[model samples]
Target: MNSAKLSHRSPTTDHGSQAFPKELASSVAISQSLEELGWIPRPKLLALRRLGIETVEDLLTHFPRRHEDRTEFPQFPREESDVPICLCGEVTKTSLRRFGGWRKIFEVTLQESNPNALSEPLVCRWFNLHYVQKMIATGQRMVVFGKPRLRGKRICMDHPEFEVIENDEEISIHFRRITPIYPATEGLSQRVLRGMIYRLLNELPSTDAGLERLTPSNLAKGERRDAIRAIHFPASWEARDAAHEHLVLTEFFAMQMLIASRRADASIRQGEKHCGAGALLDRLLKSLPFELTAAQSRVISEIRHDLAASHAMNRLLQGDVGSGKTAVAIAAMLLAVEGGYQAAFMAPTQILAEQHYDVLQRWLDPLGIRVALRTAARQEESGPLPLFEHAGNSERQEPQIIVGTHALLYDKVSFSKLGLVVVDEQHKFGVAQRAQLSAREPAPDVLVMTATPIPRTLTMTIYGDLDVSTID
Candidate 1:
């Protein structure tokens, strides 16, 4: 078996590491708190971490971006229009269909009194509301809020907000209310998430400083916390709005802080420099097959600025597939070599690394630059060129351009003047691996590349800390 393949085995497949605890203790604590508070238990914290959440702080920062009001059922408008109108009604008839899917349409008879004080029955229909139909079958009264329109002289609501009112409870007739809607995963529905949120809110310690910190100075801490509680189980629209504003601001500010911290770290630290300008870059660009796109040129300018600066450059390059990102990286590496510094390009896969090495040699060799391709394949090759064995001898100097897979990080290989490290498809690498690469002696200027095109909102929300340059 090739040593390269053996070394590349996934860590999860190895049994040598200590076993992870059967259950995450924090998840247990969170679950217990929810049970005590009578709120639905959230998914395990460990599971959430697998979804990218790592801290209690992270949990609180994830706030709903929008809201859907379902607090009251306003009376159906007298005028006919496409806009939704809130109306209160009682279901008079219900039925289910076999093989008709999970959703069911329910027809109800609404009792209303016109100006003459005479009782009139209006035929109202609700579509795809299996749950409402089930409740109606139990002879329960409901207050429905939805847009109303005449369908062949019969009022019908396609999809509407509905709440069942028992004989013991009173119904309110009102409109213009707000209710927070949460983001949810596939198996976890919004209703389920809301139930869990309610449970967690109840279990939250009243004296906890986290809540206090969340509350704005303009609003009383107790009032703010009370608003959050009420929004989950709102008694009024005003309460939901108050809670929503506070929560949204809290989440946005926390995200901003996280991003700011990362930028600060990237800026304040000094990094090894291999500064190059127009002279070397011009030579390489002239040799390339295609012209650099405006986006690529802009990113290259930004990268050059970072390299010339006193502080180390820690930037992420994001672009779509086949967007010529690799060309930009090669240009940067050549710049490093021009400044008499060694450059290392690390790819996640051996095939990709070999591809990069081939391209780098083709481009740099013509310019009289020394480029080396190192990989496990080099160790297994059966020809006159046994590069891996030659590299293993410990006497070889770091080639000007060191191209390889994770083998670039192996202790045996040493760079004469390491100044730049380019990581391709960086998302495939773990955080610890990226950190280890950056910790090399004299600390190389790090440039991370990704081919995935993430939306701007997500880029800021998810990678707020990492300096980003998009080539799109």
Candidate 2:
């Protein structure tokens, strides 16, 4: 969350919420050309533009990735420090040092900003980053943040985030209280970006940010204005988290609203029941020498209910390696076949497709279920895929089950009566590829399987329209 940016508007843009009030749009009118700002030099302005910060919104929204406390200063490092420290210092001397042929380092000698010298000047080094040489000069006051270490006799910090202090006003902004450390580019410094935001924050009104509250005031305390302020310069970490909580909740609520809308659209189209009496599925189960695990059996029951329903089945199946997902999928396919229709099983790669084909044939051949394998390699070696050579006609196609890779998505491959589609490692395919098999007058049940565990919160947001069933 860009705390400074949050001060400008509600999170409507991020989560697909409704447009903000006109008052909010007017607030960001400061997005005029940065050329109007005299403090940033012409070269640094070009660098900022390259980082996509021409407008004021881009500048403010270019949020800080972190925040550091600068209320106190640490002494020059005698040894190395694992954690990063923020320091205010003056550039005592600068030099371009040479090492291995063609390799160079830009070195800056920084003295403590305070008058009384306590230790040796810190040696801040930038190796091979050519642009740093142009920015740093001897006698320039600056603030730098980085982990310090002793390099030979010198105390050194490599590639530290440094900002040249320009004027008296910026000294307090860079030194005291909580300082925002922005996401900086090679040529940009954290101090410069923070200064720009500090000025912008001072210009904007300290109001509620004109946000239409997504959550109740009772549920999340504090106004949008307070939250925005805390994000960039909070009094404490607790304050920042408190300020950030409501905004996070608002974004999440907007996402759920979108998910509900998508779910409603999916339910509008009535589904055709492609499931038949359990004879075919039962036959396959009886043919197997082993019984289904308790988890697999429970998942099968959930899928069976969806297949028998009038609404189209949009479900995700998750199981670990060797968790019997193939068995559940076969059961689903058998049900579709029993209803006098065909099924398609898709895998992400040719090798996986061939593996599934070999297994399907071994199990289904005895039961007289004709399984066909189609892949790009096979299509090149052999002629056209028989299932869709003359797709409109059914008598010419003999396979009750077809297994293939992305080759199944070709226009030539159409199921005469597609009842179900089982996609393994479904995340590898695009939305269109996954849904292509089921896009017909009578929608086929789609069971997408994945071995990768997706966070439950994410599934609710990203795959919100689909019903989720897991084989533990």
Candidate 3:
């Protein structure tokens, strides 16, 4: 939950049954931001953002890919089996040995305090991962999970799922159950992420009152709150699965609600139904040097149908690189022009805007359509932009198709009609920027195009509000 959602108690919950007081619960929500955590540095916060983790909620949602079962350390195996044994002890001897000219092996000997539990010290070995040598310090607690081989009376494990336990608290957290292993980036270590989550959970309000206020109405008050905590630090596999089910269902329900809301909005909002493909579109296609691929043709047909409807088109056009997305976008923009309304094409970068202007100008210039570039780079080079240049004149002038970056959202930039908006590299732009551009016109048809192809399920989850048309 975000800070905004955490502050209030669910109306469905009875205030008398709350576990914690209101003041303490409010303190927990205050630390929702990364900076508020106090442990993370500025550099680390930036790195976390690169991994798509900006808030406490984002960190919690980063579920584990798999778990490490370290509930008990078994005796030296007498026979080979599939299950790997888990051992915990302190590193007694650690070194790097060269096996060949190019190969190096990192070896560490873990000594258990309970001498009677083992015959001798267990030797842990790693290959190629040189960082393991520096990471494993002498006298540090480590829990190694791997298939052990009886190497000449020495119990040795090769490249184990090893963890350097910091203290008694960390060991308790790590060995409590099937431990979660989160997906991580280069600079962001799993240990660091896990510790941060643990600290947050520790500080969070655990009282029934605090949880009742934070949890959603649909979810069971105490049960849902426990599930959220259990996901990060579960006592058993059964508990983890039960917790994960509720969270997964929550995500699915959220997507369903979003899609339903979008459908409801579409039904209520009125839009212009542009005329069918005419001379401008046909001539533009004929003028092209090559033929449109079947994928491109199919997507264009889908777009044409959306534009002809009596509602604003909120569609996402996804295509792979070199899939002729620009050509399809141009054809969609022509539908707006044919209806005697202006259109705007917004790109993420000025360089891309200039490139689109060059391509679109060549195609539409002959048809008497004025295509203009209104980027920050172009405005600074050639004095005032076209919009400002025509400001003082009695008659306001605007391009049929204006191509630019964020400059399109400026106050000086105005459109006569703005029937359609085509945003290239839609992921590069923020939601507010896209909204501002579309807000320029009165419920203009939106055709967001992306060059990078995404999986259908993911696309639906992320961009579920918009209609999807893929050219692949």
> Which candidate leads in TM-score?
2
Candidate 2 per-residue C-alpha lDDT over 292-408 given as tens digits, one digit per residue, 9 for 90 to 100:
999999999999898898878889998898999999999999888888888899999999999999888888877778788888886321123464545566554457889999999
- lDDT of the candidates, in the order given: 0.62, 0.76, 0.74
Q: Give stretches of model 2 more than 4 Å off.
A: 1-62, 115-117, 168-177, 184-210, 233-238, 368-395, 398-400, 405-416, 427-442, 453-466
Error of 3 at 445 (Å): 0.9
What TM-score, over all chains together, does every model reach? Answer: 0.59, 0.76, 0.65
Per-residue lDDT tens digits of candidate 3, residues 1-472?
0110112221111322112224423335522787777778888798789889887767766778777665545444444446676667778888888876879989999876454543467888988897888788899978777887877767788888777877564555555445667888777776777777766665665464433333365663336566666677665666677667777766677667878797688666888786445679999989889999999899988888888888888999988888889999999989888988888899999899988988887788788787878888784211124544344575534577888999999888878688899999999999889888876425789999998879888887788888999888
Candidate 3, superposed: residue stretches over 4 Å from native: 1-66, 74-86, 94-108, 112-140, 145-222, 270-279, 285-302, 308-310, 319-324, 348-352, 379-396, 406-416, 425-432, 451-459, 470-472
The TM-score measured for candidate 1 stands at 0.59
Lowest lDDT 10-mer window, candidate 1?
1-10
- Residues 110-136, candidate 1: write the lDDT tens digits: 553121243334455656655556555
Would you list the clashing residue pairs of candidate 2? none
lDDT for residue 170 in candidate 3, whole number 0-100? 58
Ranking by TM-score: 2, 3, 1
Clashes of each: 4, 0, 6
